[model samples]
Target: MSFEFIEVADMSTEADYEPKNIFLTGGAGFIGSHAAILLAKKYPHYNVVVYDKLDYCACIENLNEVMDLPNFKFVKGDICSSDLVTYVFKENKIDTVLHFAAQTHVDNSFGNSFAFTQSNIYGTHVLLECAKNCPTMRRFVHVSTDEVYGEGEDFDAKPMDEEHVLEPTNPYAATKAGAEFLVKSYHRSFKLPVIITRGNNVYGPHQFPEKLIPKFANQILRGLPVTIHGDGSNTRNFLFVEDVARAFDCILHKGEVGKIYNIGGCNELPNIEVAKSLIKILGKEKEMDDYITYVPDRKFNDLRYTITSEKLHKLGWKEEMSWEDGLRKTVEWYKTYTNRYGNIENALVAHPRMTGTSPTNI
Candidate 1:
């Protein structure tokens, strides 16, 4: 919940200028864990240190496979704690910061605006300050979402690109957009080597069950109905988790400083269709309608989101997982996970770390 920066040896000056010691926040969460694992395995010489708050959405089991690795480390703390953030960078001599920490759930953000602002906006400012002071810092990759661009497709307009104006429609998107401005300001005023990324809807394994895919997947397994927002016609692009991880890696190493890149998947579909597809995957196609319940739309739901990843593509990045394949893999992962714990709510409520019954990962 909180961390204090004690007298750890100040090794910031001795850090290598490259990404030797990488500091990644939110690394225990869905996208962060995937990126952490990828970086840990792909660059064994670099110390992949994950700093996270271990929120309800964060699961230590997500990093079980990489927990014992020589170069992998995890610190438990909130990013809002500037002292803790600064200590992590100075103590670890962290040169590269992959910022993935934030309040990501859109619906939750509506009611918990303070949490989003504190974590997403102020938390980013804390990290940027620490990063700007680090002599060995190379890249500050600020991971963002396409929702910052507001609604995507218009009557005849094409997908939004990097140059599109930022008009975030919801509290969560507003906080993220505000964070992006902070990153850009740090780059402009302090000359921090920063690059920002805006990606469309991301879905895959290890994701907390709060999101649509995993939530609905478990609901279907329990023979319960899935909740559909509004008319469920709102559209979004879904990128696989691994693909987003690779995109982050490419941006960290190859992307231009002070640039913003859009990472988007090719697949675009309606929300109801996505739920129906999941039902079909579960062999409950005949019960699709029976298994879906219409709910009130989000307070400020975006009808659609479309962002082009042309800039990232130019950096030699390409999506290797098709939506169909990606969705299948995601559904299977949830199936295996549900089988192990019987349900996500039970697993989260019972997890020692999440329940605050034990010390979080070191």
Candidate 2:
């Protein structure tokens, strides 16, 4: 199926809105980098401008492959800066916006709630304000997380749907939920064309080594034990990064405006189980005792997160890579990169104290 948006004067239908200049936020990060590359290559006619603040966990190396693409360009700026956001939006005549910038780590949010609020909530509002005034803007794709639903009892009974109430357990999720409300409000109050996507945990190459899959994989490669919060039973649905980009592309082209869609991966596993599986994948089963460490639980750890993507699936979007396959690919990439580079410190966007513990929005 074609995921290209059609150009029109009225912009009444999805096919009528063809974006020539795409403003992509957070393109230096993992998922953003992937999406930017796909859009630049797939839609060569569109100018893809990547605007990012290069936060602690954002690595410029992630975009190394597509940096030279004729259609691709990068701008170093913060989304919270109205002046910068406004300048880029007006200067580029950005008609399409894929917002993926935010302070995403739940753990860090506890100590740095202000940062999350500033970046995720305030930053999103800045974008909305700028986009609302942009005459050429057609689509605003706001990427959110499934964690907004929290781990309430209802989650155990059923996967979260689009209508699920926002019950974020941590500061990071709360900020994201707040951002969603802002985006929705803009659509309602200003008639801004926007689509929101809440995706499950995303794992693949180019991910900062702070998340579960990459964190454990890197630790294993360094001959260090993988640290697990609490008993490691907290579960989450893991989706491949490529599938996430596909979902974004589909939503950008086919998703109804002012609506929300859940992008889910069917693969779900407990944290401990995930650790064991990774040990096996790395052929470190014999060193399991030495390679796995159970730590104190997070102050406010959610038991699990589940979401249904029936809405997105109906739009011809489904995960192409299984969890095992994706995990293997991720492991192989980290192993080779580590062997060649010697330390992940080189790829880090900031000091280890920050990037290593910072929770990513994915």
On lDDT, the candidate that comes out on top is 2
Per-residue alpha-carbon lDDT of candidate 1 for residues 1-362, written as tens digits (9 for 90 to 100):
21111211222232323478999888888899999999999889989999987876778888887899999998998887888888888899888999888888776677667777888888888899889888878778898899998986564568888888888999989989999888877876777877788988889988877677887888788788888888989888888999999998887777776678999988888999999999999999987779888887877788888878999999889999998899999998987875433336642211111232111111
Candidate 2: where are CA atoms >4 Å away?
1-12, 15-17, 152-156, 339-362
Q: Write the per-residue lDDT of candidate 2 for residues 108-146, one digit (tens) a residue.
A: 777668778888888899999999999988889999999
Alpha-carbon lDDT of model 2: 0.81
Error of 1 at 75 (Å): 0.7
Decoy 1 TM-score against native: 0.89
Worst 10 residues of 1 by lDDT: 350-359
Give the CA lDDT, 0 to 100, for residue 332 in model 1: 88
Measured against the true structure, the TM-scores of the candidates, in listed sequence, are 0.89, 0.91
| Every candidate's lDDT | 0.80, 0.81
RMSD of each: 7.0, 4.8
